[model samples]
Target: MARLNLWRWGVFGLAGLYFLVPLAASVVFTVDVPGQGLTVDAYTQIVGTGGFGSSLLLSLELALATIAVVLLLMVPAMVALRLGAPKLRPVVEVVCSLPLVVPPIAFVAGIVTVLKWGPEHLSRTPLFQTFVAIQNPDFPVVLVLAYVVMALPFVYRALDAGLRAIDVPTLVEAARSCGASWPQALVQAVLPNLRGALLNASFLTLALVLGEFTVAQLLGFRPFAVWIVNVSGSQAQLSVAVSVMSLLVTWLLLLVLAGFGGRSRTTSRG
Candidate 1:
């Protein structure tokens, strides 16, 4: 028993050192500048910087949009496949998981080609307006679309697990027998049982959108991650400070998700 306990603690201790070492180095580099006493100067400058507010806001908006779109698209599709067409579930799963196998650079490259070709070939068509609108630098419809694709696998898995745990067919049948429509059945009867899954999917998608750099950067949109890299060029310490803060924000999100999830599980158990 003592040997097993020591092995477990030793493994955990090594993992903690692996994760904390770089974070400690970053904190030191961010605050302990040569000849400058420990100060909040770099952290303070994060707000005053030119693109700080806008980029962060843009990323936040993108995260929200991605969450909404993923939920709307995946939840219903997953439920229907599970309840109505079990055989199609594997096919749907493969499609959702494709984004995982496809490299982000290649995915963004395909989008770039489509964007370029749309203007040249489809300029006279109504779809050209969509192309123009999606590229909007302010709120980036393109980024949201890209993020939705990137987040599909995570959202699908979360919802699928939730669906597996519950009696989906029975729930829908009961809701229907109670004179509820399909939408109501899903919105009220089904989704309540899926609160944890919903929160988990939202948190994962939000974190993915916040941390994603290659797609947003290559797509010519400046989001939170891109801004950090841009700021690093002239203000190294400030960039590290912002990166540390971003890490904290992501961790905070995870904690919030866990809290809500725990409450949800307790309620379900009761």
Candidate 2:
């Protein structure tokens, strides 16, 4: 068993190194180019330019906003499914996971076309206008929507597992016995139990959103990914720096989320 464990660790380390080799090469290449000779010029160039900063903030905002909206939609939807229609679980799960089946580029294209034409037909109505406004014309609303859709599966699965772990039937009965309403039981009991799941979903969503480039590029959003692409073309050094910064930011957000999640889990257990 010890030998087996050692073999497994060896395999895992090799796999990790294989994945990290490209990044290592990039860092070495950025530093070792003759005249440059181990300088921090790349980092300085990326940070000195205002564009990278603006794009970083935009990406952060986009991820946070997407997470908030997704949580709002997912939590109640999950609760309702869990409490009201257990039989429809399969259907609900399929619907939420549909984004994974569809090609992201195709999804973005379809959404963008519909949104573009929607305003023309529905221009006179306030509701239509509001809808159109929410589907941001400049940034990629389609891409953000795609992120939300992709995130649903993770969020739903996590919450579903959390709900199952809590012994929902007992909690519901206890809440009812104490004269607590359905909403009260859900808010005060179920939600607390699901905090770790929610935190996991949020961090995963953040990581996806931060690194996303295809949808943002396809939809014409000036997000960090797009900025990185543009910078890479004009200045490779600056682009590397910006990428490093973005990585750091992502790591920081993940750490914060994990910390809070640990506390919430401890509180829930206590």
Candidate 3:
């Protein structure tokens, strides 16, 4: 058993090293050279290039938009499943989880085709028009929508787990006994308990949105990932610097979300 544990730790350490080595090399290469031991020129050059800033801003916007949209869509549906029709929870879960089962390329391609080929009147509706306006494959909207879809599973699972964790019957009965309406109980009791799970889902969704590349690339949306690829192709040093900056930004966002999630979890337990 001790030998097995040692082997597992050894494998985990090697895996960590494998991932860290390239990142360390990239940072070193950006900072070190023959004559100059260290320099911030690479970073300055990346910032000086106007495209990097625009792309970074666009990526951040898309991530925020995706988070907002996902929460709006997922939270209500989850609440309904948890408090309204318990029998339909499984069906709802399957439906939301379908995105994970389907190949991203295939699913996105189908969505594109439906948007292009569906009825003219339907396509011309205000909602459809707005969706197209925000999500033109030629712009950053595709990235935003793709992020929402990809992050759905995380949000759904977190919410479902949260809903399951609460003492639903007891809360409902207590509220009823106290002359509180069903809606009031749900708003006051259920929502409070679910806060931790909701925050966790939001964090997971944010991380996924920040790192995604394929949908953005296929849809021709210029985001941080695409910018990284472009910069790498042209200037190696600038590419490394941008990559490092991107990592820092992503890490900071993740840290903020993690802190919220941790606090919420502690509150839920209390």
- CA lDDT of every candidate: 0.92, 0.79, 0.79
Judged by whole-model lDDT over C-alpha atoms, candidate 3 comes out at 0.79
1-270 per-residue lDDT for model 1 (tens digits): 999999999999999999999999999998887897888899999999999889988998999999999999998888889888999988999999999999999999999998999899988999999899999999999999999999999999998888889999999999999999999998879998998789889988989999999999999899999999999999899999999999998788789778977887788778
lDDT of 3 by residue, 102-198 (tens): 9889877876676565545466666677656756634556567677888887898988888788877688778878888978877776677777787
Runs in model 3 deviating more than 4 A are: 1-12, 118-132, 136-143, 261-270
lDDT of 2 by residue, 97-140 (tens): 88778887888788778767877888888868665566574454
RMSD to truth, every model: 2.1, 2.4, 3.6
Reference-based lDDT, residue 269, model 1? 73
Report the backbone clash tally of model 3: 0
Model 2 Cα RMSD, Å?
A: 2.4
Q: Tell me each candidate's TM-score.
A: 0.93, 0.89, 0.80
Clashes of each: 0, 0, 0
